[model samples]
Target chain A: MCLSIPAKIISIEGENALVSISGMRMNASLSLLSNAKPGDFVLIHSGFSIEIIDREEAEKTLEIVRHIRPIK
Target chain B: MYPFEQYHSKALCQALVDQIHLMADRPLRFMEVCGGHTMAVRKYGIPSLLPDSIMLLSGPGCPVCVTSSLFIDQAIHLAAYDRMTICTFGDLLRVQGTNGSLEKAKTEGKDIRVVLSGLDALEIARQQPEKKIVLLGIGFETTAPTTAATILTARKEKISNFFVLSAHKLMPPAMEAIISEGIPINGYICPGHVTTITGIAMYKKIVENFGIGCVVSGFEPLDLLQTILMLVRQVKANQPKVEIQYSRAVKPEGNPKAMAIIEEVFETVDEWWRGLGILKASGLKPRDSFQDFDASEVFSLPVYEISEPEACICGDILKGLKKPQDCMLYGKNCTPDNPVGACMVSSEGSCQTHYNYAGIN
Candidate 1:
C-alpha cells in the first residue's frame, strides 16, 4: 500500500496539482503539501503529494549512487 | 537502462553485502512492514545475497492480505444487493470472505469493478447514475488521503450513490502488535512510501518503546542494501533509533496537509486485522456526519464468528513467527492460482513473494 513515485508538478489548481512522471501527466491533491509549486519534485502516493524532495539532497544521493564501484 | 540501475550493479550490491557481514557480530532479524519492500527484497533476490545469519521477515503490510473477514463479508454483502456495484483495487478480488471471494461473486453475476483509484469509483458513479456505487476503500495512510479527497469531491459534486466501505488501517499499531508478541525483531526496514506520508520521525516512539532500530528505506536495490547495512551497523553498535535512509522523499515532519485532509473525513478507531486481532485505534471510520457513505451503516447483515481456511497459517506468517515454507499448504495446495489464504493472493504478500522468488526456502 506504500507504493509511491516522484513526479514533477506542472500546474497548480486550488487543492490539486498536475504532475508529470516520465511523460505521463496525472492530477494529484495538494492538501498534504503547502509549498509544492509548479516545477517542484514531489513524492506522490495515491493521487496526493506527500513530500517535496529537496533538489540538493536528491543530487547528493544521485552523486553517491553514480560513484558506486563494483566489488571484485 | 533506468537511472536506478546503478544501484543494482552486481558490484555495488556485493559491496553492501560485504559491509553488512563486517558490521554484524551475530545473527540479526529484520522485518519489512511494507508490501512494496517485500516485493523489492524478493525481486532482487536480496535474501540470497546476504549471509544466512541475516533473516528478513515480512510483516502485515498489504492491505488486501491483512483485511479482516468481517470487513470482507460486509463488502461481499454490500456487493450482493441489487442496484449496487462494488469497486475495489485489483488485489482484493480474490480474497476469501464468508461465502467465497468477490471473484466468485463476479463470476456468479455481480457488478464488481477493479478500480485503479478511489476517484475512478466516482467516475463509475457518474456513468451509472442508476446504480449505487460502493467503493471498497481499503488501505493504509498512503491511501486514506485519496479516499478523503474523493469524499470531499463526492460531497462537493453531490455525487449520491457513491459510498465508501472503508476498511483502511494504520501501520504503527501493527508494528506494535508484532513487537508485543515478543517476535524479537532486531531492526525494521520501514516502508518507503508510508514514511513519505507519515515522515521518518513517527517511528521514534517505536524505537523508544521497543529499543529496535527503525530506518525508513526506499525501494531501490541500492536503497535496500544501504538501509540493511545501516541496520546491521546499528545492531552492531547497540544503538537502536529511528533513522531516515530515504530522506529524499521523507521529512522529519510529515505532511500535515494530508493528515488534515484525512481527519476531515475519517477518525481513528479500533480495527480488526486478519492475523492480528482487534487492535485499538488502528482503523479508520467515516465521521458520523458521513455515515451515508459508510457501508456498515448502509447494509444490514447478520454477524457471526469468522473462520479462516482450515490449514492456512497466514496469521503466524504475517507476525514473522513462521515463514511461508513452514505452512503445509505453501506449495502443495496453496498455489497462487487457487489461493487458500490471503498471503498467497496478493503479489506483495510474503507467501507469494517467497513462492515466486526464493521457492521452497
Candidate 2:
C-alpha cells in the first residue's frame, strides 16, 4: 500500500505545477493529469502529481497527517 | 479501491509476509537499495510483518547518505565567500560535517540558499551578476543530467557568475563495491528512479558478475512486494537474474537525450562515498571544455578534512552493517531537529526513515 498526500494546485506550467499542502508549497508534476487545474487537489508521489484526489480524501489525509505528525 | 483496501485481494504486505514465511528457513537477506524503498519499507512496518528468519537489509542507495564528508566541507567553503550565493536542495542544508551544517552557516548570516533545481540556481545567477552563484550539485545519475543541462544552458547564455560544486555519483559502481565486500545480500530491490534513467539492462552486468537476483521496483508497497516476490522466485529456481517491475516508467534504453547531455558536459571519475570509501569511476566531473564552471578548481581551496560525530553509526548504517535503531545515538542523540549525522538530516535517508516512522518505541 502507498500513502499519497493530496495537495491543491496553487499554480500551473506546461507539464508541472506549484502545489500547496498544509500551507507548504512544493514543486509537483502535472504530466499524469491533464485536466488538473488551479484549486484542484492532486495526489503527489515522488515529486510527481499522480492523480486528482477528491476533497473528502484530501481532508481525510490531512487529518491523518495531523494525527500522525510526520516530519519534524 | 487501492489494493490495500480490497477485501478479496490480500494486501501486498500480507503476501510479502507469506513469502517471507516460506523463505524463513533459508535465512534470506534482501536489500532494498533505494532511500525511498527504505522509507516505504519502514513506514509500512514491512519488517515487523515478516518472519524474523528473513532479514531485510538496506544499502547505500541514498545519494545524500552516500555523499562524502569532503563534499560537505567544500560546500561550506563555497558558502564562506563574501559575494557568493550557494544554492542547494533542502536535504544538504542539514547534513552535519566537521565544523557544522550549511544551515548553521546560513543562520550565522551566510548567503546559502535552498533551491529545488539547478534551473532555480541558474535563474538566481542570471538575475544577479555581481554575486557568484554556486550550486551544490548532489545526487546520483537521476539528477546529474538535469544539472548537466543547466550547465550547458549557462554556457550558451554566457553566465559567468554561475558555477557548480558537483558531487554527483553513479549507482552500479557502489553496488558492485558492496557485493565485493561480502555484504551477504541474497537479492536486491533496485532503485526505480535510477532504473528509469539507466534501465534494467544497465544492471545486466551486475547480475551476471555477482549472481545476485535483482528487481527494479517502484516506490509503492505493491511495487516493492511484487519485486520481492520476483526475487524469491529467482532464488527458489536457482536462477539469479535482473527483472523490471516498474515498466510504466522505465525502459530498457532510457532517455538517450538525457544521457547524451550528461556525456556532453561531464566525465566519470574516481569518487569517495561517505561510507563506501573511495570508489573508482563512480563520480561525475565537469568536462575539460566546461572547466570555467568548475567551482573547486576556480576557488583553489585546500583538500578539506572533515570528521564525523563520535558514536554516530552513520557509516555502518550506510553500508548495511547496522540499522538506525542499532546506532547508539539514533533517536536519543541524533534527531531530525538537531541531526548529529548525515543520514538523519536527509529526507531520503535510512536514519530519517526510522526517526520519522519506525521510532514508535
Candidate 3:
C-alpha cells in the first residue's frame, strides 16, 4: 500500500500536475511539495507527489554501485 | 532506459550480492518494515541470491495486513445502514472481519465502493448530497498525507457529506514494539516511501535507543541488494547508524509541507494492529477541529470485539517469528483468491508475496 513510482511533471494547473511515468500520463496533486514545477521528477504516491527525486543523487548512487567489484 | 530502471540492472545486483556474500560471514537477521520491500525482496528472488547466514524477515508493515479486525467489522456494520456509502481501497474489499467482509456486504446490496484515492471519495460526496460518504482511510505516513489533503479539499469546498474513518498509522512505534519484543534483529531496512514524508530523524532515534543498524531503502532489486550489503558492513564493523540507500527520493529532513498538513489535520492516538496489538500513539485520527469530517465521531457506531480466525498464524508471521508456510492453511485453504487471513488478502502481504513468488505451495 506504500508503493510509489517516480514520474516527470508535464504541466501544472493549480495544485494538480500532469505527470508522465514511463510514457503514461496522469494527474498528481502537488500539495505535499513546496516548489514542484514542470520537468521535475517526483515520487507519486496515492495521487500526491510526496517528494522530488534528485537526479544527481540518483546518478551518484548508480556510480557507487558500478564501482562495487566482486571480492576475489 | 529510465533513470529508475538502472537500479534494476542484473550486473549491479550480482555485484552487490557477491559483496554481501563475502562480507556476511556470521549469522545476521534483518527485518524490512515495509510491505513494498516485502514484495520487492521476494519478487526479485533476493533470498535465493544472498548468503545462507543472512535471514530476511518481513515485519508488520503491510497496512492492510495489520489493520485490526474490529475496524473492518465496524466498517461492515456501517455498510448495513441505508443511505451510507463505505468507500475504501480495493485491498480492503476482500479482507474478512469477524462476521463478514466488505465484498460480502457489497454482494448483499450494500452501497460499498472501491476508490483509488481519498479525493475520489470526496467526489462521491459531491455527487450524492443525500448519502453520507465514509472513506476508510487505511495506510501509513506515506498515505495519510493524501487523506489529509482530501479532508482539506472537502473542508474548502464545504462538503458536509464527506467523512473519513482513519486507520492511518505511524511506523516508528511499531518498529519499536518489535524491537522491544526481544526479537534477535541485527539490522533494519526501513521503509523508503514513509521516510520520504517522515525523514530520517525517527530512525536516528531508533539507532540511538536500540543500537541497531538501519538503512532506508528503495524497492528495487539492486537497491535491496545494496541495502543488505550496507547492513552487513554495519554489523561487521559493530558501528550502528542510520543510512539512506534511497537518497534519490528520500531526504534527511523529509517533505515539510506534507508533515505540516498531517499535523494540522490529524493527531496521534492509540491504535490497534492485528498482530502487534495496541501501540501508544501509533495511529492517526482527525483533530478535534476537523471533527465534522471524522467518521468515527460523526457516526456513533458499536465497537465489536475482534475475533481472529482459528489456525491462521498471521500474527506470528507479522511479528517475524514465523513464515507463511508455518501456517497449516497457508497454501491449502488460504490462498490469494480466497484469503482466510488479512495477510493473504493483500498482494504486498508476506504470506501472499511468498505464495506468489516463492513457489512454496
Candidate 4:
C-alpha cells in the first residue's frame, strides 16, 4: 500500500531507471515507461512508471508525499 | 532535517495498533474505502494486529470492480470492429463481458491495445489516423484529470480519430452511498490517490451527516495502521471528523489545476455501477465542447441487459455486505485462472486482494 510519486529521472539503465523524489533517490522499472525523457516527471508505481506526472502537479504531490505523517 | 526513514514508517504501525487496542473495550466496524488500502491492510496483517475490537471491511474502491457489465460489453463491441483500435489500461482487458472479454476479442484478432495512460491512446490516434482509437476511460478523480487532459489536447489538435468511452466516476458519492445504505460502517479510511486530486474536503458531507470518522490514508502498511488509529481515536472520543493521515499527498483543498481541467472537459452525470445500481450524477461525461470525442455520439451500442454469470458474489463483496469466503464460489469455482466475475479478474479487486494476502484458508 503506497502512493505513486512523481519523480525526476536522473539516469536510465537498460529497462530500469533511477528517479529522485524530494532529494531521495530510488529505482523504478520502465515496463510502462514511454514517451518519457530525463527531465520528465512520472507517476511511478510498484517498480514501474505507469503515467507521466504533470510537473506542477507532481511537485505539489511531492510536497505532500515527502511529509505524509502529521508534523511531530 | 526530516526524520522518517521509511515511507509509512514502522513506528506509525505499532502506535496505530496500540491505539486501536486502547479503544477496544468493544468491537468496532471500520471500512477501508480504497482497494489498495485493503491489499495493504491484509499484506501488513493490520486486521490481525487488532485485539478483535476493530473490524476492517473492503469497500467498492476498485473502479474495475464497480464498472457495470454494459461498459465491458461495449468495449468488446468496439474491439470487434476491424478499423477500431480499443485501447485500455491492463485491468479492464481480462474483465469478462456477456459473451467474452477484450482479451478474448484480442485473441480473436481484434485490435485491442493496453495503454499505461490516456496520452498513450492519444499517441496511437496520432499514429494511426486511418483507424478509430477508442480509449476505455475508467477510474475515479485521480485518473479522470489525465483522461480529461488527453481529450483537451485531442480536441485542440482536431484529432477526430480519437474517442473515449467514459466510465469515469467520482469517489465522494460512493462513500455517501455506503453510509446512506446504513451498512454498519463505523468509520472510513478514504482513498489516498482520489483525495490527492479531490482533497479530503470531499468527505465533509459524510462526517456531517453520518457522524463517521473519515481518515484519508496512503496505501502502505504503516499508512493503514495509522489511519486505523486515527479512526479509533475519533471513535473513542465519539467525534466524527475528516483528517488527512496521508498528509504527504493530500490537503484540505485538492489540486486546483487538475480540478480546473476536469471541470473544463467533463461534467457529472447519472451513471450505473455494478454492485450499487445507478448513482445519480456520480459519473463523468464529456462536456458539450468536446462532443466530438464522445464515443456515444459516434457509435450506437445495442441496449443489452446481460445477466451476471452465476455464483459471482462480486456485488455483495463490493458493498461490504459479504466477504470473499462468504461467496459460494470464492476459490472453488472462481480463481484468478478462471474468473467468473470482474472482482477475480481485476488486480485491485477486494476478492483478489483477500485471496492473495488475507489468510483465506
Winner by lDDT: 3
Which prediction has more favorable TM-score, 2 or 4?
4
**DockQ versus reference, model 1:** 0.47
Q: Rank the candidates by TM-score, best first.
A: 3, 1, 4, 2
B1-361 in candidate 3: lDDT tens per residue? 1567888888888889889988989999999999999999999899999889999999999999999888999998888777999999998899998888999999999999998889888889999999999999999999999999999999999999999999999999999999999988999999999999999999887799999899999988988999999999999999999999999999999898999999999999999887889999999999999999998998888988988988999998999999999999998899999899999999999999999998665
Better of 1 and 3 by TM-score: 3
Whichever of 1 and 2 has more lDDT, that candidate is 1
Root mean square deviation (Cα) for candidate 2: 7.4
Off by over 4 Å in 2: A1-72, B1-20, B23-25
Q: For model 2, how does the per-residue alpha-carbon lDDT over B147-244 read when each residue is reduced to its tens digit?
A: 78788889999999999899898888988888998889889888876765566777888899999988887665656665776787788888999887
What TM-score would candidate 2 get against the native? Answer: 0.82
Give per-residue CA lDDT, model 4, range B1-361, as digits (tens).
Answer: 1223354456545555665576567778888777677777777777788887678888888888888878889888777676999998888888887888888989989999998777788889999899999999898887787788788879888899999999999887888888788799889989887777777777888999889889988666766776777787788889989988766556567766668888999999998777788899999999887889998767887766856878788888888999989988888888777778888887768778778876355
In TM-score terms, candidate 3 sits at 0.98
Poorly placed runs, candidate 4 (over 4 Å): A1-3, A9-72, B1-5, B8-12
- The 10 consecutive residues of candidate 2 chain B with the worst lDDT sum are B1-10
DockQ of every candidate structure = 0.47, 0.06, 0.81, 0.10
How displaced is residue B29 in candidate 4, in Å? 1.0
Worst 10 residues of 3 chain B by lDDT: B1-10
> Which candidate comes out best when scored by DockQ?
3
Query: What is the lDDT for B171 in model 2?
Result: 88
lDDT of 4 by residue, A1-72 (tens): 224666778788875689888788887655443456776666665345545544453244334434444332
- The alpha-carbon lDDT assigned to residue B145 of candidate 2 equals 71
